[model samples]
Target: MEERPNNDTTISTDEINVLLGKLKFSEEESVQIMSTNDGKNVKGFESWAVGKIMATEHPNREAMYRVFKSLWYTKEEVDFVALKEGAVIVKFGCLEDRSRILKLMPWLFDKCLFSMVPFVKGKNIASYEFGLSPFWLRVYNIPIELMDRQLVVAVGNAIGELVAIDWKDRNGAWTEFMRLKVKIDISKPLRRIVKLVSRYGGETIEVIKYERLPDFCYMCGLIGHTFKNCKDNREGAGINDSNAQYGSWMRAPFVNPNQERNMRRNGVEIVKTTITANEDKEESQTNSRDESGQSAQKGNEKEVKKARYRHHLWKKEVISLYMTAWDGLSIRGSA
Candidate 1:
């Protein structure tokens, strides 16, 4: 059997370095391998043979170092780690304001983005982004730049407070309800601090597994497709070309009838007034027709009563004529 090289074997610094160099040490791994007890037991590791052994699995420290140093890049390049709770952790990471995030989006795709959001839908949730966070973070498909500054601030504040409320509520409920899930919100401030230090540099994401947006089949509630394309009752159908994400295949929010009229006239108020007037006119006509029908019935009844009264009066003999005849007869008899 061939003799195995020992870790205690004495090896010259130059020989060990040569071996490490051949292994293509990353800067860090090179530092480690080189810093070992002055090449003790690193004999067989002194050259290409040594490099071949280390190359089987371990990273080439020298090679890594050369790449980083040559690029003149700093540890900041890879300093990002994922939030512990993933999306929920994102709920906690807040910015000084929300607009700050909007401004950072383009750069976020290019670099790392951090910060907390406290409130989401009245629940306290927090989130963090790996440098790899995508464009889905855009608010309503409208660039933060296009939105009113006040709205951006409001949305940010609201998101922050939302997560806070939910987190607190869940915590409270969890304490009372033993069966309630125990939550995990991992934030390694210490890790960040340590990485920020001179020792362990920041590291970029080594991997990503993506899950595409869902297809729950709702039109109006900001899901899958447009209402015109909806399979449900076609009550909310119409083309909404004016949508902010008009051509985007991701989401389709079609404008309904009233909206279409508004677009046709280029005025929302017009549609509202027209619809209002039409409804009011129809209601009034219905009320008036009912009233007129009642009045006509009453008129007919009055005419019938008058006709009957006249007939009765016509049927009555004239008492005055009889009286006249009697008086004349009396006068003749007397003569």
Candidate 2:
């Protein structure tokens, strides 16, 4: 026999033969069990009772546990339990109260959109055949696996209404999940799509439209709002352009240092170079390193000395050459 786990969450996939099934015990001991049946029995076995019975026969305890599970299929499964002929009594597993399904509208709508359903709303809902819904509305393309049982009941409990009357068809036959779909009211949420679709269809650049709208500056025709509301402008821009000369934020006098007039007045604009006002000032100061004006006086002195020296040298050289030539000719004549 297989031993049972005291913990709430777990299961085993062990196997068991027919000998263990013949034994009897309690359901609590039989949890987290795995089993393979050697044969079938007319009477059905309960969860707790089987574990106690098999514990005595099989020392392994695992064998008995496997046998119990093979015959019972004890794992929790999604299922519907019926209270009456047409209605479900149990809300666990697959059988959830009708009101629970109603509150799933938002999740359903989101799922519908995720699944790429073109439109999802509750009015005249039968056309898309969402089955039975309690909110008088619905969104399609919802994944069935996502609808949790507890959530469905919670939704019903919150709204203080039955999510739906999980009823069998008029035929009064037991309904299987494969055939079941929900019914709901679809009128309200449907309008949301009308506007969404209108904008989606009308605006060609929807990405830019949706993302850029909040950022637009009315004064500049730029994104992120106008200068009046702009945080950047308010923080020491120091000037405002109430009267826009060029109908543009740039042309206006809104403390933009790049404006032409400000640049010109401040010498920030260097016509020949891309230097700023401070850089131009620095360049001019560098050219005037001799601020005491001694450099100018020294330059004048150098010029005067060069002129006087050139005049004296030319006069001395010419006179010396003339005397040498005359002496040479006189000596030749005497000879």
Candidate 3:
């Protein structure tokens, strides 16, 4: 065998290269790596739609700069650029940061309202356009039994069109108790008189026009984009077209055979009238009982609960009767 060198003398090329790469020097030239886009698909620039500022006029460049400087986010966290027509484009450093800001949107900043919307991809940030957005109506106080998809769809169709129906599942499975989402037409005046009639038990479901529903896109059946800007193939009719017809249908008075049934039922007045009559008869007995040193507070509380339960039962029974009467009238109208 040839004479072998000692361990210190015989250095491995791989070990030498590794040691050289780790060496740092003050005079070394910094090599900057640049990405070249050869018309190939690359990572997208994360952005959000920022508009609906409540200021009298659009915030200027200096104002926006001051606003951002006052709020959260460092220079590296986000890139805020003012777009054409008072809109804004916010590019986040990461998706998590973007999501966090979106959750905090429609925020009240500097005593002005600023609403955030979903950004459209492949569209120039400076030229993206928006229009009068469709709104969402969250209907609470819905009875558990009447929350079927079919019933929700029927009620939603009457309002405008069923963008989506969210069901609240308590046990990770479908149940009778749920909530509903119905899209309302923004162009036409609200149809506040429409009632949903249940086919199974003939119960009249009354929905109150509580508040403006959140924006849900009918195109992609998702919540984000305001109306048809989702770029999905499915397009909804404008308020002038299909929504107008639906609005008219909803506003039409339901024809009940009895004139009393067709007219608006004064459930509160009925309850009050019945309660007053009962109170008058009970007042004399109550006075005598009070004179005899009987406790009247307990009895009065019991009477109030009874009256409330009675009023609720009476309202439900009367509404059911009206719905049944209307069904016959609807069949007659169809014939």
Cα lDDT computed for each candidate against the true fold: 0.27, 0.27, 0.45
**How do the residues 84-203 of candidate 2 rate in per-residue lDDT, one tens digit apiece?**
112221122211211122222211110111000111222221233322222221212223443343433333333233323222222232222111112222311111111112223542
User: For model 3, how does the per-residue alpha-carbon lDDT over 1-335 read when each residue is reduced to its tens digit?
Assistant: 89876764545556778998998856445666676955333223544445544334343445544454334343345656765456776656655555545433333333233555566666654454333233334443456666565665666667664543333333332353233334443333444544555557664546443222223343332323334454543454453443332222222233333543333222112222334566775676588676865666466546655554554454444344434433333233233
Looking at model 2, residue 233 earns an lDDT score of: 56
TM-score of each: 0.15, 0.13, 0.35
- Relative to the true structure, candidate 2 reaches a TM of 0.13
| Shift in Å, residue 48, candidate 2 | 28
- Prediction-by-prediction clash tally: 59, 52, 2
* Candidate 2 structure lDDT: 0.27
Error of 2 at 168 (Å): 36
Point to the candidate with the largest lDDT: 3
Ranking by TM-score: 3, 1, 2
Which residue runs of candidate 2 sit more than 4 Å off their true CA positions?
A: 1-76, 79-94, 97-99, 113-128, 131-189, 192-335
Q: Report the lDDT of model 1 for residue 252.
A: 23
